[model samples]
Target: MLDATTITAPIFIEDMEVGLTRHLEKIISDHDISLFAEVSEDRNPVHLNDEYAESTMFGGRIAHGMLTAALISAVIGEQLPGHGTVYLRQSMAFLAPVRPGDLVRAEVEVKSIDLRRSRVTLDTRCLVDETRVLHGEALVLAPSRG
Candidate 1:
């Protein structure tokens, strides 16, 4: 098991700055949608059924919004304040639907930092081409130097 006390955060709180940004990209695939549906138990037809989805407002099956949002989490944990950071809360707004095969780009920017509390707030977003599919803010406890 990993020990939190001994493990140092990849980027310490003192090193972070406003406007620091990182991006990650992935193509939403049929396999991804299916696995996410299975893992989340969100068998919504709009995400899994073709004909049924065609009857809806979107007119096509789409990837689960949370699946796209997961990319934002990836950018945070693997990129920006990477590794040892701890997520406190996330507020998301789903702006558009992401269809399978869409190339999703997740971006995160450090908006504010509270070094005294070892916390940081970031602006998070996911885009498909020029369209924003999801946007949000995330609060996390950053790793410390000491």
Candidate 2:
């Protein structure tokens, strides 16, 4: 049996030297699309209307910006941060369109650590093949005994 507390131990800068990588492949299920539409209430034709999307620059429906942003959360929450890590801040740039069938892989690396403050800087990116769909930096508060 896996102990939740042990699994959630705070990861320090040195601890992250081993590095972490994760790959995600999704077919952009209808449920994910519909949920994004409902929550954001952004009826952007490019994201909601197939006909409108067909005429747009994308030539087809594309996922919302926030939907793509969620990929970052997955990287931190499930991978780097793991269970008990707390998010501090994030900065991101969207570079490419994410279509319904596109497969996005998010990569995160610990760039720097402020041990005194118990904070870490992470380099994050979401990509499809060699093209980056999203790029950003994330700051997280690492748990410490201090």
Candidate closest to the true structure, highest lDDT: 1
Candidate 1 structure quality by residue, lDDT tens digits, 4-112: 3554347788888999998988999999999999999999999999999999999999999999999998878877798888999999999999999999999999999
- lDDT score, candidate 1: 0.91
Query: What C-alpha lDDT values do all the predictions have?
Result: 0.91, 0.75
Clashes of 1: 0
Q: Which stretches of candidate 2 lie over 4 Å from their true place?
A: 1-14, 18-25
Q: How close to the true structure is residue 127 of candidate 1, measured as C-alpha lDDT?
A: 95
| TM-score, cand. 1 | 0.93
**Tens-place lDDT digits, model 2, residues 44-132:** 87888899999998898898878888877766766575556689899999999888877777787877777777777888888877899
